[model samples]
Target: MKKILILMLMAASFAAHADSFVKGADVGWLPQMEATGYKFRNAQGKEEDCLQILKDLGINTIRLRTWVNPSDDSASGHNSKDETVAMAVRAQKMGMRVMLNFHYSDSWADPQQQRKPAAWANHDFPQLLKDVYSYTYDVMQAMKQAGVTPEWVQVGNETRTGMIYPEGHTDNWPQLAQLINQGYDAIKAVSPASKVVLHLDRGHDNKWFRTWFDNAKAHGARYDVIGLSYYPYWLDGRPDYTLSINDLAANMNDMAARYGKEVMVVEVGGEDSQPQNTYDMLMAVQQKVRAVPDHKGLGVIYWEPQGARSWSHYELSAWGADGRPTKAMEAFRAR
Candidate 1:
């Protein structure tokens, strides 16, 4: 009995050590932009040094989003694939792991919008699947050539409504699974060590998670991680932050246990323009995430701190107008 107790104690210590090493942030584009003078510092003189600042705050990973083609004119606009690979390379140089989020479109791809890339619009469903596979493979190859192999690859972003939509809807699990599998296969072909993540919105809804994942499994969609997007104001109408965080963490733990996969709060953040209440909620959520078991919970990622009203020309701001680290960022550190 004494020997068994000793073994258990050692196992517990190992688990704690593992958990302590996994804190991360999704600040991929921020750092690269910091070099270009897109500031995010506050009045305290905390400069918008994304990578260095995140490293100082215990962040070990970075996530970047990639789009197929980002401009309607095609003459001058952001080249998402190139920019993402550049960011990944820089992150790796900073000793942080990279997770590439493929939007599979020219612009933003989310639950409400899954606009097909112009090149793939003419293709039928089967042809589109092939295009997905080929595009994924080509991108992986390009990243590898650039010496920036990602640690994780997301087939699509916030795909609860399904990606490349009209055909890849949630109800068409079998076809969607095949498309996802193609992406997985492409990633494995280059970086076999990389993990494949299946991302979805609606982190607070446990029933939605269960149904979605169960259906994916039934369709033979193999994935290494379950990614969730949690936005308090949008997801929960009342905006009760504490309850929402607790609920999300609990649901994540439950889903991990059921699916035998690690959980990632892949996209999570509140409007920086909001008061201390929003910050408090974010911190509470981080605390709850940290308390989860190491084998189940991986980490939480803050979506886009620089995209806030203070820094960008884009309206519908998510960040504050001051270009400083909001209460939400401090909450991210759980300090």
Candidate 2:
């Protein structure tokens, strides 16, 4: 009888999670932007807390990236463990769900570069695995201490070619899977309720996702969510969302069906210069994600939508030069 009750409670928890559609944004740059006097304004051009402005725009989830032993560079650094915990606590205080992205490096970890942190650079393969687990566990423990339990946790950032390179590159699937599992296990150890995400870039490319995930599965990579980064403007030769929207929808559907896991556009954005087009693109992207059967399509998250171009000089942000959110952000209001 006790065992039956425990199973029912677990099922209820999962049902609650599935029913919540996440409208999120990765605002890892918020702290630095604010520190440098970057202001965020609502529709009326009135200064407001950035998170409050985002929450008003229907963002229920906030994603922040953490780097290992990062510098204090305004643009390239400052996502250290303590700062991340502080940010997570702030977001949670505002009644927002948190998603922590572990970059596993002292800097960016993307498809083009996945350098190991200087501290871990000298570690052997086995030590590297232990480093991954220990770092992940420590940060997660910090969040727990700060009263922030992230709803989702990414093992690595945009690891299309794999992460912690040299040893954990995609070419070395066995080692890569070990590194991934170390993070996964550590996350579960700290926050068992948090869904672990294995992220990749190019959400519309079905072939690449199939190849990568198939390898992960064969090598026993454990994760509950498949995270994708969709940037229409970044696609070569197909720089328009119209050209790839359908493809992204198809890929999301296929990922859910093939891997039997929840799918999320963990990162997405449009050109800030084209507000209307970006707004339309965002609406269409959300539509496609919601269209996925069985609610397997978790939701879409705009990457740094509030990282105004004037401050970050990032073209894909959804903020204007005047420190106000562009019309593109209104797409989230539909949620």
lDDT of each: 0.74, 0.94
TM per candidate:
0.86, 0.94
Q: Which pairs clash in model 1? A: 40-323, 41-324, 69-106, 308-319, 310-321
Q: Candidate 2, residues 27-72: lDDT per residue as tens digits? A: 9999999899887899999999999999999999999999999999
Error of 1 at 294 (Å): 5.6
Taking the tens digit of each residue's C-alpha lDDT, what string does model 1 give over 1-335? 99999999999987775555345566544533554567655437577456766665556778887778776332223546777788788889998888888888887789889888998998998898888888888888889999988878999988887788777888788888888888888889988988899998989889888988889989999789998888776854756666577678888888888888888888776655574776676666666665667556677776755465544443322355666555555555543
Worst 10 residues of 2 by lDDT: 13-22
Please give the TM-score that candidate 1 achieves against the real structure: 0.86
Clashes of each: 5, 0
Q: Highest TM-score: give the candidate number.
A: 2
